[model samples]
Target chain A: MKTRIFSLAGIAVLLALCIAAPQMLDAYSLGVALQLLSWIALTQSWVTFSGLTGYVSLGHAVFYGLGAYVMALLWQSAPLWEILLGSGFAGALLALVIGYPALRVSGPYFVILTLGLSEFFKYIVIAVEAGLESSGRLIFGAPDPETLYYIMLLLAVVATLLTWGLARSRWGAGLRAIREDETAAETLGVPVTFLKIAAFVISAFIPGVVGAVWVLRTTYFEPMQLFSPTTSFTIVTMAIIGGSDRAPGPIFGAAFIVLLSELLWARAPHVYLVILGVLLVSFVLFVPKGISGQLAWLMRRRRA
Target chain B: MNLKSIALRAATASAAMLLAATAFAVEPVKVGVGIAQTGMFAPAAIPALNAYKMWADDLNASGGLDVAGTKRPVKLIVYDDQSDFTKDAAIYEKLITDDKVDLLLSPYATPAHFAIVGVLERYKFPMMGSTAASVQLKAVKPGNIWFPTSALPDVMGPELVKLMKAQNIKTVAISTLQSPFAQEVEKYLKMALKDSGIKLLSSVEYAPDIRDMTSIVSKMKSEQPDATFSLSFPGDSVLFMKAAREQGLSAPFQFVLVGPSAAFFSKIFGKNLDGIVTMGHWSPYQTKWPKAMPFFEEYSKRYNETPDYLDVALAYMSCEITQAAVAKVGLDHDKLRKEISSATFDTIDGPVKFDGVSNASTPTMFLQNQEGKPQIIWPASDATSTFQKKGPWAN
Candidate 1:
């Protein structure tokens, strides 16, 4: 009871800070904060499936790219709320369609399949755009930085709360059981396929929404930029580096990586990635469970 | 009382002195540039960055830009966009809102520049596109943005078609990377080719990073066109050329858009580039413009290498135009933009006059590679050498 109250209080304080950030900070800081929120949302979405189920996705950027395109295509005609909701639904439908076939395969095969799916989607979009004879960066008028910051912050908060809530529920237990031993969990009548698909769909929806919001902030989208494989690599790396098993781990990981990259990119643009690689490797070697897991382990040790 | 009186007097006197110093000192004009210093666009963007830095250094050395009556040094605030459009937008936003730069220089390529148009328009910062020359930019038509030394594909197409017609070229094969600029070029070239007594035998658009062009070359070879034209980046241009050479495919006339400007092509192709035609905006060999030779000499002296006209000459001319405008208008963005739009400036690339859409009508030179060097070979007055009608492999 005490821990639950503390967590709620901490969340409330964090929410308050995020709400005040746009007003309190300058445009540069707000921009950075918006990116941080985006990464948090993306990392948490990745964690929803990969964290509990141990199904690492390398092509999650497909949903993001698709969501961005949907928003870009509809921005002029539709209301902003409709665009966001539509993109989320689009992502959920895609996830359901792809997940049914993809969930059947496990391990590296599934990872490769997801990667291939993203590449396939990229080429398909390019071909369609070519067919229409439209081949330039699409720019939608962007919302002000403050409004974008709020939307991104709201998405990040909602994604975190959903992940936190789901992690403690019975669904979470089944997923965890599946991750530990899929055949044993199946023998115990866990409805393994349903749980996996559910997690994948939920994960897919959040990134789609985030991507829609990102398109609003960015105001421009090219197929290559939107569907970049680098985005998928960054998202997965953040989730793993943060501690994939815990709900808060991805948030921690995302914040560290985004802030570090942003800070270093301005001063040392060339070797920033190399520096980040070193840090990621060092963290993995020293604390295999990530920051949240290490902290939890330390607390348990102190209690014992 | 005596001690407090002395301290108060000392503080007041120091404040007065500081105010006097501040009043006399000229504030530096801040110029912001977001270029791809790393990543895929680095090969083109880095040279532009170096050229801009050199321009700033030279201006500061000459007692700065003459703004009104006072001389104000330019302070450049540059950031790497890592060749990502989204990052370019964010960095430009920061440059506008936070750094509060007085002027803006465009990112190196069309896509990156296109990405930040909204931000530039929203902030009403006038930008001079130095390296980008896509016709698609005209569709945006932001009044504040200017392209000084670059010509759109539509403008270049008619000239190229006329040149080809003069050469008695009957059939042509065209290929391009599926980028916005390349697409625009291909579209305009086809339109120009219509009813010009020239047949387009084959046109193919390949994916951006396609390594092998053997199939495309073979198809073009089979068509047996009089001429082959490809609009691609440096790497892809080299790939296509290598593939054509390996397949023993040749046309009476062949033109590539990018590779001839760089030393990389000369090093790789050597004598194979002889008689091949390529398009460029400026060349060191063009001595008609008085500033061309001096600019070339200065750049070579500073950089310890021969400068590509696309990277150095065009970027330097952009800075010169900016300096001239700022000098005339004294840092008022609206007045400076008007001055730039309404006036004709004599740059190192010759006369620059913007069309209704603020797109410059710069001349596009078609040069022929002769003994590992390019010489202007078209547009009779600018031609230093005649166009070669046939290549070594021509049947």
Candidate 2:
């Protein structure tokens, strides 16, 4: 039954994407969707690690930036597949390294540490690596556009699939247990350490890969741009709005925010940021399970 | 968001049918105008786009941009990229494939338009870009596909470099936008000024939200260079001036600010900007075009405000080109491109033509910031304001 639902939903979404792609020959709408796609990938990764496992990441932009840099470096040097694998490995490796020390920390400390780590990357890219000189070495180059777009789309899909796969896995069950009660999970021999490490690493991997794709698409990189606190907040808000732990939460959150951004931003053209912040707060306070989360709960309730 | 596809389909079917009729009837010239009508880069885009519309209306007033004696009304196909390069690319594809516009007026931002330029070049569309700042964008292989309409920093940088050297004030410092457009220009400016025996004390890439650069300014002040250089935009420009003044910091006799957008930098900063040096976009006094007086008069009267240099630079120049092209080429599309490429016309900005590189235009004056207004201080002859020897804010 679960497998059949997955097939049906995936086919529906795929059909929607395929039909929509050709129809969107105009630039205005497609561009918004592309940006939303980037955030969707980012927040879903956040949802996978933080929402499902209850381990919030404040510095997820670090992964995006890392991905951007790696993809930028790989462009023109490697083929498309090689760039993807290389970016994924680089992000996964960075996540694992950070995860070892990071996932062990508790409460707000983990949050602060993650943010600090993200900032460290930001400063390194902007201040130290400004103009692509990092410790007397050139580290990044802008990737070709079509190559970057295809890679980013691929990464978003792969990350989405990974999210679905993890949700039904043993590790996912362990994460749920850990979220409910870390002490009890440990007492139950759920391998809390491995589960946390795995979750953190996977979360980092998605954003990192996405970041690399971003840099490639831009063909330009400045550290402060990819590693900023605003980028992290945007991702977190998307995850929260989407019902962090659900399959479609991040997608819905990203779409909702992207729409608000288009209308408010188009109207004002000066500052939609304050508006976005207010909407996020209101959604959290009143919307309960976010748009997708609420829908999921309602559908279940109707079934009961 | 999902409505984008449906919208695209509707726009294509309707717009193509509308355009095809006029195009078949008398071959009405199709002009492409690209802007960030949607995304993250929309702020700068809205004002910049006013120039395109202003030009369209002005050119259309003369019964449209003329080509030879066969006068055909010009059509403007406006597209909103929603501030995405991917979308910009897609639109360029449609503009080339379906609409088949004769010429393209690009968006305001550097990164988005820069990417769009790559796509346009592929399809061989004649494009005029004004808002991009990347110096590399100017170096495109000599052709009529793209022309840099505004006075780019690459040309202006060298002109300013001459001013900085003449002053003999050695140490220089700078900050630039983290955007690809700025990144490309910053790359060239740094390289061009590298061998000029100037010591750049610090070069920072700061976010647009720098309220007051208390630390960066103070740190620079401690070193005490003869002059300071900045490659920042509007919001940061005000903050830098205020912070530099509040901290009683005077690092440079000149400030080559990139995005002062009109001579309003001085007006915004008040007396604090007296000695501040900057660049000019389009000084009314500098222009010799016939329509300059009327256009300025109309803008001032309608808006109840003075016309600034940046808009005057783009608005007048684009309208001037459209007029010249229409007069030369009648109503044919390909002929319009040829006319635009073949003829060098006098504009409000001065006699200008695309020099093959979509980046470089005829270089304009590098004015010093006197009383916050970038008065033409160089070339001694074009000096509009009496050389206020060391502005009030100058040490």
Candidate 3:
């Protein structure tokens, strides 16, 4: 009861800080905060599906790219809320279409297929844009950064809650069962394919919305840039660094990377990348459970 | 008083004067920019960065940048945007809101430039842009940012057709990179070709990350057109060049849209690079622009490599315009914007005057790699040398 109360209090404080960010922070810090929220939202969504199912995905960028494309297409023509909704729908629809076949495979094959499908979709978008003879797009008169920040904050909160809720649900347990022993879970009467697809679709929705909001920050969209593999790579890196085992892992991970980059990029851009590489290697080799897991272990030890 | 006492008094007085001067030296002007220090666009962006660096060095060497009557040293606040448009925009916002830089410099690439227009508008900051050209730039509201490049795709398209017509070339095959600038140029080129009654044998568009030009070059070879125009960026230009050479697709009037002017291109191709025409408006061989050769020589001497004829020239020219404007009206944003838009500043590319965001003075021109040197080959007035057909590829 004490632990639950403390957790609730911590979440409340975090929510307050996010709400006060636009009022308190300067433009640059607000931009950083927006970036942090975006990563948090994306990583949390990834954790909801990949963390629970043990089916690692390397193509979350596809949903994000699709969302941004939908935003670009419907930018000024539709209302702001409609554009965002349309973007989210585009991502969810794509996820639903790709999930059934994609979830059939497991482990490395699933990872590879997700990546391949992402690339295939990227080329398809490119070809579509080319056929239209539109090379790129720039969004004029995008809402100010402050407005975008609030939207991102909402997404981040919802994503975190969704992950938290799903992690404790019976559905999460069944997914974990599939991760441990798929045949046994199937024999136990778990709807493995349906659960996996649902999780995949749930994971994809937020990233899509996040991508739409992100593009407004730049107001420029090129297919190659929007669908870059680096986005996927960064998402996976954050998940690994943050510890994908818990609901709060993505928050810790996103904050760590964003703050570290903010502190170092201005001073030493290249060195920051090198340090990131070193940290990633160290985490994979030594601290396999990541920051959140390590923290949990420390807490248990203290109680003991 | 003894002679020793008199000498000591004189020395003390001179030392005191020196200290006072040091204390009173004007504060440096903080000019901020976010450029691609790493990632895909680095190869193209580094030249622009070098140009900015060279300009600062030269100004400091000559008693700093002239701010009205007083001379203030320039301190450039540079951030690496990593060739990401969104990151580039964020860096600009940081530079404006956090760093609080006094002046602004443009970032590299068309997309990065387009990304920051909102920030520029929001802050009412004026910047002189370089290395970015597109038809869409004209659509941007004309106050905060001005493009010094005369190589607008719409203009270049018709000019290219005129140049081809001048050389008596008829049938042409075109291949383009599916990038905004490249594709825009391709669109206009096709329109111009159609308008001018030039027969288009074939047209192909390749993805920006395309590596194999085997099929594209083969298709061009099969057509056997009189001219082949590869509207490509640096990386793809190299791919197209290699594929063309290996496949021996020797269209006499071959024009690669970009990448020939970079120092690496010549180093890579050497004699084979000769006779290939590329887009550029500036050259050292143009004696009319007296400052051109000296700027070229100084850049070459400082960097131990040849500057990109198009990007570097435009980058340095932006600095010149910025310096000239600052010298006229101190670092006031409104005054700088007005001066930049209205004033006819003398640049290495000759007199540059912006008429609503685009450089109205500099002519849209092309350059050819003639015997390992970039020579102006179009718009007779700007041509340092006449146009030439492609020679046989080196073995």
TM-score of each: 0.92, 0.79, 0.97
**Which portions of model 1 show Cα errors greater than 4 Å?**
B1-24, B371-373, B376-386, B393-395
Query: How high is each candidate's interface RMSD, in Å?
Result: 1.7, 6.9, 0.9
Residue B9, model 2, lDDT: 93
Q: Which has the greatest lDDT?
A: 3
Candidate 3 DockQ category? Answer: medium
Tens digits of per-residue lDDT for model 2, A186-297: 9999999988888888877778777766665444545555566777888888887877777678878888888887676435644677787787889889986788878877
- CAPRI accuracy category, model 2: incorrect
TM-score of 3: 0.97
lDDT of 3 by residue, B106-205 (tens): 9998999999999998889999998889999988999999999999999999999999999999899999888888889999999999868789999998
In candidate 1, what fraction of native interface contacts survive?
Answer: 0.45
> lDDT ranking from best to worst?
3, 1, 2
C-alpha DockQ of every model: 0.42, 0.14, 0.75
Predicted candidate 1 versus true structure: per-residue lDDT over A167-270, tens digit per residue = 89899999999999999999999999999999999998888988888877777667888888888899888876788877789888998898888889999998
From the highest TM-score down, the ranking of the candidates is 3, 1, 2
